[model samples]
Target: MGDEVPGVGAHARYVPGRFADQVALVTGGGSGIGAAVARQLAAEGCARVNVADQDMDNAESVAVAMGGTARHVDVADADAVDALVSGVTRDCGRLDVVVHAAGVDDPEAKAQLLSAREAGEPVDVLARLGDERWRRVMSVNLDGTFHVLRAAVRAMRPRGRGAVVTVGSSAAFDTLVGYPHYAASKAGVHALSQAVAKEAIAFGVRVNTVAPGPVDTAMAARTPAAVRAAMEAAGAIGYASAEDLADSICYLASPGAANVVGAVLLSNGGRFTV
Candidate 1:
């Protein structure tokens, strides 16, 4: 940690020098947990941060606020992800951290359940709980992570040093009935990160995952009140905020976590206590 860190505005927590001079690229950096992580990293003194998202306007707002750069990237598109990586490296000179936080919720699944309760609609035949939904969820959560990690490793291996923090979900290890697809994709993310860490150790790269539980983000806002209450009651600390998860991501991206490779750091307010 250092004094007078770069991008810490009034609201940031303890400023840390963990990422001084590092260049970080955060996907889905426009809002919620991704945005919080970006702000935290910038506050910690990373020299350059590329805040990327599918929405350029949102991304630009975040980047500008953070005093960083913004890039529009569709993570599902491997070519676009590669180009974004190349562009960031070309412009910034080096890459040190990669944080993938892009994600989506199953609105259709939620709708079907709501309809079943309200109008006696058959929940099994919901339009949103099908193959297409599964594909989209996996495409962004798992495949998108792969695309970014692939490009980042290509850049990091040459330097022989880098850190990657992928965002997973507590659902990966728990039973989340309506969001089976989301849970499966996040589980795949954990497995993928572990495999990457195993292969990358020799190259001096570390890959880890952060599986957050019921974070107070837009996603959590969409959860039913009863479900949210249940999650909160089950947790030792009731709720975890985006910044709480961001702190863990920052730690994984730091030199202090050098020995912490291929690990899944759970920031779930004791919801999935080991």
Candidate 2:
């Protein structure tokens, strides 16, 4: 179309208004790709966008600026996820689309990996990465996705038509080196989305995922600058902005993607094509 439009946050980009009149709920809408997704949804003509995140302040900031509602939620908690979905449906009357952008990092992995290098200690990646770190990341990224998808299906089944887009990572298909937990969680996310798509299809709900490579986000900042630069040099298109990923997500949720079920729309800037 060779066109563009204003987005909600500093990270988003312009897009068409195919989403007009739809109601969307975006989890992890406080910042990064999630924030950008909420903004794109708003700019694309969503009548109401519920910005759900554990960080109420950021969620509120994004929601208020975009003329949508803010919600405090921990997607890892099944009950809380269900409640958020119910509340949005009860108040907004219907949820035409859902985008799950909530994912977590392994703080323990980062701290240990960085500290060992800083202290001149022999870096043992596995030794430093405890079981807790793995579980925590999986809980938030994989389990949380399951919870949100399940809840959304329950609500959408009654309506008999809906669309869902979950944000995943290119790391799932490649190596993330020191962050095995994060990689594993994202891999599970892709598998889970496909499984859910199969189940939800019978209910008229289509579920899919957008897997982006190293994008310019706080999460990417965790990588050592030297390593990031080296990786970028090897990549076909290097890193992309949050808006790029958001653009793909909005496309998947829009009517143009009505038949793109159980698919993973990879927006990795040509780094990983799978």
Candidate 3:
């Protein structure tokens, strides 16, 4: 509705009963794509949705609106992540679906890089990258994935069935942003997803990764307007929406994706089509 865009139209509102009787958990469900996915699950008749996020206020808001539950969790902490899954499994009586959408973006560091560039200072992104930033990013993006997937795998093992969908970035493959740490962490997520999928399949559990591009999110705001516009135009759909991404995720977690495993669904709006 914004500009008579060819592929743009009213958002798909509901997938009624798509997840009836299911219990789902979404990390980073406070806002953005995570919140969208959680809401979609609830709309689709999920028996329960655990809205896990580091932001207590936002998480609580989303949970209350959806009539789910909120848990303040830092995905970077393995112990916390494990405990979360275990508790959810205990409360829900079964963990049927999990979407690892939780991630981080250091706006402060981005501001520094831009400020240094404006000041005519040499901006060696890698050389200037701090060890702390790299570690923190990896911990949240890669290690956090490990913690959740591993614990979920174990829980699903006893049930003999479950589905896990992870959120990866298109940066894992080709991104012009030039943020090595973030890119690498996402790449790790890609590989980890594939490996975990292969391992979980033996126990009737499925895992997949959704790598989206040019998403209109708060994190993407840090990029220059020109850069963002160019990226959007390059995509086949001309833009990315959180709801669209959630659809792919829901599909993967649903029985429709039963045959799909160890695959990375590159939802780039056909920007890098195979």
TM-score leader: 1
Model 2 global lDDT (CA atoms, 0 to 1): 0.85
Error of 3 at 112 (Å): 6.2
TM-score of each candidate structure, all chains considered together: 0.91, 0.91, 0.90
Which scores greater on lDDT, model 1 or model 2?
A: 2
lDDT of 1 by residue, 1-274 (tens): 3344344464445466668889999999998889988988888778998999999998998898879899999999999999999999999998999999888878766555555656754555324567888899899889999999899999899999999999988889875656688888999999999999999888998999999988898877886665567678978887788888888888888888999999999888887665
After superposing candidate 3 on the true structure, give the runs of residues whose Cα lies further than 4 Å from its correct spot: 1-13, 112-123
In order, what lDDT does every prediction score? 0.85, 0.85, 0.84
Q: Clashes in candidate 3: how many?
A: 0
Structure candidate 2, residue pairs in collision: 5-14
Candidate 2 lDDT, tens digit per residue, 1-274? Answer: 3123343533334555678889999999989898888888887778899999999999999888878899999998999999999999999999999999999886556656666667878656775677777788989999999999999999899989999999888888876667788888999999999999998999999999999887888877886665567567757989888878888998899898998899987888778565
Model 3 scores a TM of: 0.90
Model 1 segments more than 4 A misplaced = 1-8, 113-128
